[model samples]
Target: MELKTIEELNQIGFEKIGEWKINKRGALDYEITTDKTTEVLYSFVKVDNQKEEIIYIGKTIRTIINRLNGYKKPGNSQFTNIRINKEILNLLKSDLNVNIYLFKCNDVITYKSHNINLAAGLEDTLIKYFKPKYNLHGNQRIIDDVELSENLIKLTNDMNDDKNCQNHYLIEKTTTVSNLEGKINLGNVPFSFLPEYGEIINIYLGDIVLQANFINGNNNGGNNPRINCVAIGNWLRENGINVNDNFYIKICNNNSFYFSINKIY
Candidate 1:
């Protein structure tokens, strides 16, 4: 059987008394076909952030539409068999592409009572086939939306390796930097672990990214030289982070003494 679209399902009536679906929204928005309604409910179905993976699959027996609609809300956390985080739900409704592929049968099966068995089989078949992330019975391949670069992963692993890093100290703190006249006062940071001047570092302000250069200054007042990088200061301003916005810094590993700066919020 082929999965038919909403328009196609309307044109070609179902011959079997089993389940039918009209694609509504998200990755897989399906419902037990009924006499009324065109098709689809965003609930009882969800797609991952990238819309490349189907995250959840569900079935409703009586009052299928109501059951499907219940998934839209986070009630007493009792409606859904699997946990659906608020963030995940928001992503599903926002970015997930909805489509329905009706697997209509040849033989006609009309009434809802008879369609129960058929719906069960169809739901099970889809759950097993897709192995949706939210499914508890089928292929429980749960994967989140966190994306990590290979180099970042390796750097973190290296930081945690005792053999490579002996008595390594990790500092994760929120700090605000000073940018005055294209000069950045890095403050009382452990600059001993940092590389020489002219090297590059990364700075992220929300979605905006920037590459910053480290230029040495004269330490005439018994303090370490401040970094004079105009590009980063300008980039921060461009990204709506002025000279004193709180930025979160994460050092994947001091093995390279490289730290990545991220915008808070």
Candidate 2:
């Protein structure tokens, strides 16, 4: 399980699935030739010229495309999804190419009349050996990459709360000067009523969508729930959203939400 380089992956039969990238508008772009519906153990590698670096390794029973979609449009509670999406977007913005490789375990072993998932079993071992920089050790620390901040690794346990995934919830808030400055306080809103801490939510202002991170105030006991969205601050300022402007967030049936400025203020 001492996987050191990308060459080891190809030598061990991992197939290159596709090259993934996001457009300027942050849309997913890739050409996948493998079966899109099968479970897989995959890796994300960045290719610069002839150099290759494995950034992540993960196994998913939900197929490659579905998992990629999750990374592309992460939910409010999906810290890893949000983190990886940001990493991918930043790298793409710098013109780095990320490629994906998939491995399907056809060699099955049965134990006690139950089929063993080789892909699942091998994931940890490979991660331990390869130690992809983005892979976290039980949400505590990055496996190989130590540069990530400790606070970032300490995200909420309920990372991807997708319950009632199809229901649209309305979250209304009035814009304050503080909100327009990027720190939005969910005044008097119960913690249980909003997305969990460390969640990344998509807020729409007209046709534009801004991704924001939900967090607690100076005290971490959900004392004051707030959202951190620098983009929203710029958008609000640019669009004449001032103090006392009313805005409402409409959580969509999908993994996104939209907001409208009731009063342009």
Candidate 3:
């Protein structure tokens, strides 16, 4: 059914179909389906550690119940559904909540969605507007991303060429010491994208800023510079990233490096 409001002025007999939650705790292993003959549905899922966040927003031609139930089954031919649901199941296995929500739509409602092409078009619009994580497939609102790129000049040091370059060196004898906050390790960490050593690396962490030097290489050319864990840990700590967690040291420009935090294991 197309979305419609019960407009008094238009004399349309529109009633909003409602979604009720199903407790999946007991029958998680079983196939699930819907009670209603729903034509359109919106699913809202909250992955673990994100109780406040609806990590994914989705719409389906099937009823909300049947669609969410499809995740538990194997041999799904839709590659995107299979791929994204794997992530969802992982989150669920880790004791994270995958709360499925839906918006109800029915055929007998005596009103029409004004000027909208209806179901599929509305779904696309909702996906773009919400920017949900799991809707990686389908049409995207590239305008927002393009505008962001326009605002920030492209940082050009692509790591592929840097990785294969002869100038890349892995310096040794580096150590990580533990502080009250956490620990740093003794390892040869490479900031492969940096072109020069002993140069200032400015890391902006919210209101706090951390600065470190890219120590020059001791090789014959003495060209490859690196910033170790001691510097990295401190910078991450200031920015709320743990030292033990996997993170990347990205050199965006000469004066700045972006430290991206990844998962612990």
Candidate 4:
């Protein structure tokens, strides 16, 4: 069935549930409700003779249900509506149970730009932590290992070219770089550095080493760089890196490193 509004979703009921942070004002706001009004829930559908499987999970506050309804429009929605994708639709339709949950709030909330970012981050973190099958985007595994080795080598070679360069050493097992091969088609390298040291660095396809830089560090004074990390993660996921793997990172005064694949989501 097609979901139109928050009320409709509530009326249909749900089988599983989750929570979301909503901004009551223009700042970061939290709604604590014992009534499950603050959470988004899910339901499942059984395909063929298989058991029920969750298809969607979401929440709404105020009249924003109109936005959900608008998803029916072609090419305008962020998610591919099952109605339009016959393959996915059939898969869900054949499911025995479809789980869905709704979070409703009486008061309207206004979100600031930064607060939106925070909410997004919170949502992403929760989805990643939960590993919900319906949350496909959250299941991405960051490409580390080989990519990290390659970037470290490239960086080492680059720095080595400088005659005045001092000793450069990467923190053992702390350096991690994402491999980007298929996603990007054109321009330059896309790389993202996590400032907390040892976080996986995402490098995009077609990105060069010159574009990579630390997110919140000194950058050691050099030209800014950008690399594709999403592509790397996609490649790794396709190749066998599990999304739930335990990522370890290490950083030294001059270098960084990452090690091991612990899990896949």
Candidate 5:
């Protein structure tokens, strides 16, 4: 027999039609009068406004349907009726407004045998090919990649022991001059040290270093200690420096200061 039209079948509410055939395995094999069973497998709802989207694809199987709805308490069944039930429920709740298409079969093979096996094989192939979002097994490769990136970031962060040290110092002051002159700039410092200083100081000092000029401020003078404590504090926090570490800021000139981060790691 020829396969029934999709529109016609949907109008009849898939359950009332009883014309089907049973194969040797007691599985239902609907005889398609017009198209082959493979064609019916190709028909599926395109999801997410995709021109080539194929959400769900499967051949009509009487045994599969009977097994799904046969028992009021299907929880004890060997087959994965629970998963199948969820899949159907998800489809009904989907925002894409997808419709299910039923193909009437004229043959019924023995249950759990060749016909059922063929239907299952076809289902697996379709699941792999289209990768429906609702299907849990579908799109596994992409999901694995996403999961891997998250794991890597978590692992790297976990390796850092002193990640929350707030009062860390970045620049160590080791030298002092009675009469110091010229520009001081911290921008020439290594990129690794840039994180030690808060983002603002890093930007300012980095710019100064790049220009080869030091920021000569009133904080360091001939009589007073020539250390930019504010800049050092910013650097410490940025680099995860701890307050317990003793360090000093070395003034390179009026425009820049050398930041030394105390190692607590």
Candidate 6:
């Protein structure tokens, strides 16, 4: 399938049904009143002045209102809804602008002897072609990169085998709210990955270094050790490192570590 831009989708049949934004009470609200029962292929787009980019694309047989409500107050079992909700909230918190667009497909076509719902069929095509970041399919490539963590573990072991080696590495996936807030759980990392608790360490994000205190989670009843570096969180957000992206840390010594990001494409 070929990639289609929002403009191309608009030319094909998509419509600007309305916009969506967090309301005063922190709930998602669409600007124009819409039919609660209309099934649709909807998209979330980020707008910056005249520039627009599609971030997510989805189709639902469920009522449009019901679909949006799924994002507003996602159920525990609704993983997609939950992820999208967190992403949208994060974007809004950063003071970025987002809008929603919709398309209703009425045309039915037969494949072989079976009729296909155009919206349903088009959903996969759009996702595969456009690759909206918030959609699961859009993140498949980055998710596959998690294999890099396994390889990195092996490398760290190789380095640790050397009696004189003090350097180690940790490859972690950014999957928690704490990660975005400048705290990283070191529970899964080896004890040697960081210095002794209460010691100060320099965290390097490129050339920028932030000295931070270390708290060994083990000493605190097995609580995960953390690096509370607000600057790293701000850097991640500013650099568009959303949740689920993989990042690596190079522990150069007992007193310092550096970061490298594998951003989502």
lDDT tens readout by residue for model 4, 21-58: 22334221122223423223222222335443334432
| Candidate 5 lDDT tens digits, 25-80 | 64323332233232123233434554334444443222333322321122221122
Q: What are the per-residue Cα lDDT tens digits for candidate 3 across 3-109?
A: 22113201322122232232366223422244454434354455445343445544443445555554444222234345655776566566765554444433332
Instruction: Rank by lDDT, highest first.
Output: 2, 6, 3, 1, 5, 4
TM-score for each model:
0.30, 0.53, 0.36, 0.27, 0.24, 0.49
lDDT of 2 by residue, 20-95 (tens): 8776776756667757545467888998997999888876655687677777776654566878888887777788
Q: Provide the lowest-lDDT 10-residue window in model 3.
A: 142-151
Measured with C-alpha atoms, the lDDT of residue 28 in candidate 6 is 58
Cα displacement (angstroms), candidate 5, residue 259, comes to 73
Best by lDDT: 2
Show model 4 residue runs off by greater than 4 Å.
Answer: 1-52, 58-64, 71-73, 76-79, 82-88, 104-122, 141-265
Q: Which regions of candidate 2 are displaced past 4 Å?
A: 138-265
**Model 1 Cα lDDT, one tens digit per residue, 1-265:** 4432233333443222222232454422333455332211122333345334445544332243444433343233122321444434455456554332333333434464432234333444555565666554356421111111212111222232335433223444333455523454544556433322323343333334334444334222112334444554565556565544543443322212222245322
After best superposition, candidate 4 residue 115: deviation in angstroms? 6.3
Worst 10 residues of 6 by lDDT: 144-153
Question: Could you give candidate 6's per-residue lDDT for residues 120-214 as a string of tens digits?
Answer: 55665676667788765344532211111111111212222234335555555655667788877776666545443334455667546556556
Local distance difference test values of all predictions, in order: 0.37, 0.63, 0.39, 0.30, 0.32, 0.61
Worst 10 residues of 5 by lDDT: 144-153
Q: Per-residue lDDT for 244 in model 1?
A: 49
Evaluated at residue 120, the lDDT of candidate 2 is 58
Q: What is the lDDT of candidate 2?
A: 0.63
